[model samples]
Target chain A: MSITFKLDVLKPHQPNSPTLARALKQIEGVKYVNIRVEEIDQKTTSIIIFIRGNEGLLLDKIVEVLDGNNCALHSVDEVTIQDD
Target chain B: MSITFKLDVLKPHQPNSPTLARALKQIEGVKYVNIRVEEIDQKTTSIIIFIRGNEGLLLDKIVEVLDGNNCALHSVDEVTIQDD
Candidate 1:
């Protein structure tokens, strides 16, 4: 199975999109990660992240990574699971 | 190159999500299509569509198909192009 997620996140500027993407890519089963900055504030950046991975993809781990980075997950905009 | 698009559309309920997805899959180069209905009014349905395809995917053709189905494209939320 392959799972794809579209997540909205708000985080401080320290871990920019590249940093965030790299961190997420390190997660088990993660195959693709794309982070787009939607808005920028003096201290924070609002971004949309798209991740595609296999069945090993766990939402809990994803959330944990974001939390570790001091990022707040606003919402999970979309999630799709497809059988390979 | 492969492209992914996230589109917001509003249309009558006649051509439901499944119908819409089938139509979109017929487009050249489209490999995956997922449509999720977010809101339902008495006469219309608001949906978010995610499409993945190769370089052959054309935005004009997508819009044309939606227009043919009387769908109003509210916005294109995201677009990503990646080299394969």
Candidate 2:
């Protein structure tokens, strides 16, 4: 089975979005990563993240990467699972 | 606050992936959508979905879209919320 996650994230408005995208794409089974800015505050930026990967989608690993970059996880908006 | 969700989805191997992506992108506050195939069986395909959008992400609407297409949502893998 494969899984996909749609995440809402908050991050400081410094590190480029591509940095986060590259980090997420590096995860095992992660096939694609896309980040879009939702809102821009004075210091923080709200973003939506989309990730596609294999069955064993590592939520923790993704968390670790985001946390390491000082990004906070807000909420999980959607999930989809595929299996034969 | 904005929210993002990573979803694992199951879909039949007929409708093109872009169709789903386009449908998702049409959602309000949905800035981007990415879908990737993980495993392909004889009849089904495992896919991972990533969606980024504003704070008021309507999970039900997304579910409605997937259900309308005969797709099943298996799990929500990740959620990130961004707030100032």
Best DockQ among the predictions, by candidate number:
1
Rate residue B50 of model 1 by lDDT: 90
Tell me the lDDT of model 1 at B29: 80
Best by TM-score: 1
Q: How close is candidate 1 to the true structure, as a TM-score?
A: 0.53
> Alpha-carbon error at B76 in model 2, in Å?
20
Candidate 1 lDDT at A59 equals 70
lDDT tens digits, residues B1-84, model 1?
999999998979777554566677678788787777687788998889898889989889999999988898999999999999
Docking quality band of candidate 1, CAPRI definitions: incorrect
Q: Tens-digit lDDT track for model 2 on B1-84? A: 778888999988656465576567677877657687777778888888888788888788889989887789999999899993
User: How would the docking of model 2 be graded?
Assistant: incorrect
Off by over 4 Å in 1: B1-84
- Which 10-residue span in candidate 2 chain B carries the lowest summed lDDT? B14-23
